[model samples]
Target: MADVKKVATRQSYGEALVELGAEHDDFVVLDADLAAATQTGKFKAAYPDRFFDAGIAESNMVGIAAGIATTGRVAFASTFAMFAAGRAFEQVRNSIGYPHLNVKIGATHAGISVGEDGATHQCNEDIALMRTIPGMTVIVPCDDVEAKAAVRAAYEMEGPVYMRFGRLAVPVVNDADSFEFEIGKGILMREGADVTIVACGLMVQASLEAAEALAAKGISAEVIDMHTIKPLDEDIILESAKKTGRVLTVEEHSVIGGLGDAVCAVLAEKNPVPVKKLGVNDVFGESGPAVDLLHKYGLDAEGVERAVEELLA
Candidate 1:
């Protein structure tokens, strides 16, 4: 069990891949020209022979990963979330998802956290895109510990997996040995009845902060880390919605069809409530610090708190 200190989820994925590669030779690493940025360079250094640098061609890289998976090799393709889900959609859909191949797509620089590079680099639509693909397992770890666990889990699991991570260092929320990662289970971070805050990725930290703010004002907000967006712990979400009359969905992605939409869909069919979505709001991000961009796009802790307040009112 490692310490539960603050660390970026991307770093956890990079470090875990190296450990997994050292243990399993069949575990191969692939990168689409952004090895260093995506942190797959660590695995490349550890296992040079098993690492393949596809060099800027994300689509080709996805196809190669799918090909490798068919050969009984567990292939992990690392790239920015935008390219992995958006640019390599068809390859992932036909080559990987359709076949239900054991291909782990570790998409770093996900959401508005890949700030300074602007909206082009940020992947606000990755969840919606990846979740639409059949047999695809979409996961966004809440912290570094969960990130490491998700990486190991994805490697052992059989199917096309999309594990999303961010570029910036986030507050570590999960204890290394305290919680175990489950494919379709939603972890309850904090419990309340005033409202439920369902969040993923870096926004999990924001959701925690919002819960704390709401607590100060006597508004108890239940915080559920909805890491697996595809399977989506619908039971937990519905239960929370039933307890709380209002629900708030938070993510670093777009509000259109991402985490917010997925939660809304479940709530609409199961337990509908006054759900408020906090995210990019259909606007493109600009070049700035990751934290600044989060604030600008209304995905930060302050924004989440405001949304909760609005819904409560």
Candidate 2:
């Protein structure tokens, strides 16, 4: 696995923006002085005329993007997740989300994977905040392939799309040539009948590795990438839970209002099953190395495998 190719989803978002810029001229990008870190600098470099720098005001940047959509032009507001979803929550909910504008929010460096940036910059609550906005579509792609496709899909669709991109380089688990991405649709990565393991973002690859470990122990775990958080694919969760009898939800976020809670909500309504949530234990992140932080927070493959064994026991 060390030889496997890895790419950060934030990089994918930047590359995808450049590709989209070449194909369409109706969309403009706005950044809040973090264009380089957010990877929107690529789009800025390519289409300088179409890029807007709103200084350090993320709220104003979102508002500008919303204003751009009024003229029938799509706008992508790029910034770190903490600012885009946290600091700009009022503007995002009122300016973009309330009006249901065609604004695509590119939230990069999301989750605890933000590493040494610590709790203030590491956003584990963005998904919950974004989902609360009416008609806002939340997407957390698993790898480079899905991240690029998700960005393209958000552009083609008509509505406010909140996309979360990671700072950590994750394994390219999906085959670019064979993979297909759809908004609000979950992908069934590996099938099994014992227990279903659902994950998103960097956690998706960790879930896959956990599945393999479970298989070695004769646990037959099913793996799913719930890329789209809002308008979640309830049918897939019900179907997998029906077959597996149990489910586990994993994420690089807080357990309060992320992937785990979203999946549990569906199962509680449609089908009742035992669910083990593998994520941050309702706590803030500390400054540390990215890989070491994930291990400490129990968001890695070994942590996931251990959670599954405990759930089964």
Best by TM-score: 2
lDDT of 1 by residue, 1-313 (tens): 1243667788889999988877888879999999888888898898899999999899999999999999999999999999999999999999999999999999999888888888798878899899899889999998888999999998888888999998988888887778788998999999998989999988888888888888999989999999999888899998889988889899888888888999999988887788898888887778899878888778888999999999888
lDDT of each: 0.89, 0.94
What value of lDDT does candidate 1 attain over all alpha carbons?
Answer: 0.89
Clashing pairs in 2: none
Candidate 2 lDDT at 31 equals: 95
Give the number of the best model, judged by lDDT. Answer: 2
Error of 2 at 219 (Å): 1.0
How high is each candidate's TM-score? 0.97, 0.99
